[model samples]
Target: MTERVEVRQNVLKENDRIAGELRRGLAERATLCLNLISSPGAGKTSILEGTLEALGGTPLRVAVLTGDIQTERDADRLKRYGFPALQITTGGTCHLDASMVQRAMASLPSPDLDLLLVENVGNLVCPASYDLGEDAKVVVLSVTEGDDKPLKYPGIFRRARLMLLHKIDLLPHTRFSRDAAVADARRVNPEIEVLETSCVSEPGLGAFVRWIEQRLAEKRQAGRPARD
Candidate 1:
């Protein structure tokens, strides 16, 4: 058991080392990297689709690196918006690690993008533990899922900078309590920003886009050289 624990720690240390390098490299380019995490069928791709459509024909150079256990389907869906998109098939791996992202970055059309959204493999458990060198981690929770998820998966909620309460269009059909969900999330992470979104009705979709634009602007500002 001691040997097993030691191996796990060593693996995480190496992962963090690589993640640090990736973070610095991205920072130098003023790229805002966001790691999106959620369970399977939680609408990560759908939100990306809406975001890509909203940001299309704009000057913002955006790209996506979506991960999955086996298929290239998510990447395919995002590419329809005419932005660069890549699929990292993990081959049964539960999460995307820094090394996987580093290798995949080499294949992008250009590394100078303003926004790099990484849709991590859809497992709220393991993906929360792996750092892909993102500026922020966004957790997506669909109303179709349990409202108790924030309490159940405190690790992800605690570390997330934002929680997108997606699929709000179906709230009338479901028993999901929006107030309970937000309150519970705050209990774990008081600073976690919550956005109620629905790709179908498009409520809060504009706000989501504005949030990204704001973050991207902030990233660019931070990367600027200080004037004497």
Candidate 2:
């Protein structure tokens, strides 16, 4: 057990070192990177689709990189939306690491784009430990997934800067407790910005887009060359 623990620690340390480099590279190019994480069926892809549509023709130039255990389906879906999309099939890996993201970044349209949205492989546990050098980590939770998700997956909830409670259109049909979910998420992360969204009804989609724009603007401003 001790040896396993040490190995895991070493791997994470190396990943963190590489993530730091990736973060600096993104900053140099003034790209705002977002690491979006969630479990399977959490509506991550749907949320991305809606978000891309909302951001379309806006001032922010954005792209997406989606990860999966297998298949290019998600990437293909995003491409239809007319955004530059890349798919990282992790084979058997449960999560994406900094190294994978670094390679994907190279193939992506020049980091000149205002934003890069990374939809991490659909898993809650392993992905939480890997830092992809994103400006903000956003976790998506659908009401159907239950209100206890935050407590069950506190690590991701605690690490995330924002939480999107998706599937608001289905709220009327399900027994999921929106207030309980938000309360639990806040309990774990008091500073987390919570937003409700429904791709079907388009509720809160504008706010999500605005939030991304704000982050991109900040990253661009910070990356600007120091003027005398």
Candidate 3:
């Protein structure tokens, strides 16, 4: 019991310590950052690509920091979207730490950027335990992955400020239950802002973008830079 308690305390304390420093460093540039987390193949990258496309003409100057264990492939893929992007290869780590983000800040193009999307290593479990000093955490899930995902990963679900359900376009051919997924997610986090989207069908995308715009406006209203 003592060991477990110590571990928990250390994790929280260490996370807050690093997160505070991160907040200070980012404040110099006033970059609105969003940390995206989900399991492998949960459409985190796709959603990001879609977002870049969605906001291509918007006033927000967006850049991306993509995390992967093995390759720089995700970053390479985002280049075609015609935006500045950096890939942070975690070198087999399952999650991103505050130090990794802090280091990337020096190399990433700033002053011209209003927002940074940090695509975290794809793992629903460990990512929740680390705070990368993001304005908000966006947890993504796909209907193809089944409805019980939120229940199975309650920690990530509960920690998310927003939950996104992707791949709903393929729902007709599959056994996925949209209502059940949303219901299950609400059970874990009743206050979590949820959005359903399909890159293929492009349904509910306007709402998603509107949500982002609203968030950015809210940040500005709070006097924290309206770029997240």
Candidate 4:
């Protein structure tokens, strides 16, 4: 058990090194990188689809890097919105690490972008352990997934800056308790911001886009040199 723990620590140290490099590069470019994580069928892709569509007419330059175990379907769905979208097939890996993201960044059409959204593999556990040098970690939770997820997967909730409670349109049918979910997430992370969203009915989709825009603006402002 001691040897195994040491090996895991060594691996994480290496990942953190690479992530630090990635973070510096993004900061230099003033890019707001967001790592989005969730369970399968939690509406991560759907939310990205809507976000990309909403930002299409805006002047903000945006790109996406989506990860999956096999198919490139998520990237395909995002590309139609006229933004640069790439797929990182992780083979059988449960999560995307900094090395994979570093390699994927090289293939982007442009190095300069205002927002870089990385849709991590659909797993809350392993993904939370790996840092991809994102400005923030955003977790998506669907009403169909039950309200106990925040309590069950505390690691992700604790680290995430925002939680998008998705599939709100089906709230009338599902046994999901919005109040309970929010309470549990806040219990895990007092600073975690929650947004109720639905890709079908488009409830909080506008607020989601505005949130990204605001983050982008803040990143750019921070990167600007201070006046004497």
Candidate 5:
């Protein structure tokens, strides 16, 4: 058991080293990397679809790297938006590591893209432990899910910079309480920014899009050299 624990520690150490390199490389290129994590049926893909529609014809370039256990359906769906999209099939892996994301970066249509969104495998526990070198880790939770999700999955909620309350259009049909959800999330991570979103009615999609745009701008600004 001790040997196994040591091995796992070594593996995570190596992963973090690689993730550091990836973070620097992305910063050098002025790319805003967002790591999206959520449970199954949380509407991650649908939110991306809505975001793409809102960002249409904008000067900012966007790409997606979606991970799944078996199918390429998420990547295929995002491709319809006319941006580079790569599907990372982890086979049986429960999460996407830094090495996987580093490899997927090469498959993007252009390295000059302003934004890269990595839709991690639909597992809250494992994905939260793996850093993909993203500028921010966003957790998506559907209203159809329970309000106690943040309490149950405290690790992801604490690690995430933002939490998106997805499928709010179904709130009237579900027993989920937004206040309870936010309060629970704050219990774990008080600084976490929460956004209520609905792909159908798009209640807060614009604010979410603006958040991305702001991050992109900040990344670009940070990468620029100081003028004399």
Candidate 6:
């Protein structure tokens, strides 16, 4: 048991060190990197896809790196949006480690991108334990999953600066309570910013786009040259 604990601690410490390096790289490039996390079927990809579509004429240059366990399907889907993209297949891994994201960064046509979205492999638990050198981490929870997800996955909720509540259009048909979910999330993370979204309805998409633009603007204001 002690040996196993030591191995785990070593792995975590190494990951955090690499993550810090990744963060420094992002800052040097002046890129707004977002680590997106959520459970499978939480509509994280859909939300990002929709934002990419909505922000087509926006001031920011957006790029995406999608992480999945096996297939390149998600990355392929986002490619149709006409932005730089890369797929990081994690084999059987549930989360995207700093090494995986670093490899993906090397693979993509991403140097000029103002905002980089690192769509983590769909898993709330393991992904929360890893950091991929991002400016911010966005935790996505679909209403269809259950309103208590923020309360259940407290670690992800607490670490995320933003919680995107997707699939809000299904609320009338489903039993999820928006108010209760927001309250639960705020209870865990008092400063968490929650944005409800529906890819189909496009109800709250403007707010999401505005948030991304704001982040990108902040990056531009920093005036740092891209790291080679």
Q: Which one wins by TM-score: 2 or 5?
A: 5
* Root-mean-square deviation (CA) per prediction: 2.9, 3.2, 4.0, 2.8, 2.9, 4.1
Those runs of model 5 whose alpha carbons end farther than 4 Å from true positions after fitting are: 1-11
Candidate 3 residue-wise lDDT at 25: 56
- Give candidate 4 regions above 4 Å deviation: 1-11, 202-204
Against the correct fold, how does model 5 do in TM-score?
0.93
Number of the top lDDT candidate: 4
Give Cα distance to truth, residue 202, candidate 1, Å: 3.9
Tens-digit lDDT track of model 2 for 50-108: 88887786776788999999999999999987789999999999999999998998898
TM-score of each: 0.94, 0.91, 0.89, 0.95, 0.93, 0.90
**The 10-residue segment with the lowest total lDDT in model 1:** 1-10
Least accurate 10 contiguous residues by lDDT in model 4 = 1-10
Q: Candidates 5 and 6: which is better by lDDT?
A: 5
User: Under the 3 Å rule for N, CA and C atoms, how many clashes does model 4 have?
Assistant: 0
Give the clashing residue pairs of candidate 4, or none. none
Name the runs in model 1 displaced over 4 angstroms. Answer: 1-11
Q: In model 2, what lDDT does residue 17 have?
A: 91
lDDT tens digits, residues 125-163, model 5?
999999888999999999988899999999999999999
Error of 4 at 122 (Å): 0.6
lDDT of 4: 0.95
Q: Over the stretch 1-228, how does candidate 6's per-residue lDDT look in tens digits?
A: 355443335558878898888888888778899999999988888887887888777666788999999999998999988887788998999999998887778877657667899999999899988978898899988888989888899999999999888888888889999899899999999999998888888486777888888888887777656587
Query: What tens digits encode model 3's per-residue C-alpha lDDT throughout 1-228?
Result: 355443335647876788888776555556667899988998888888888888998778888889999898999988778788888998989999888887777786664566778999999999998999888899988888888889899999988999888887878877888788888888988998888887778684677778888877665566555585
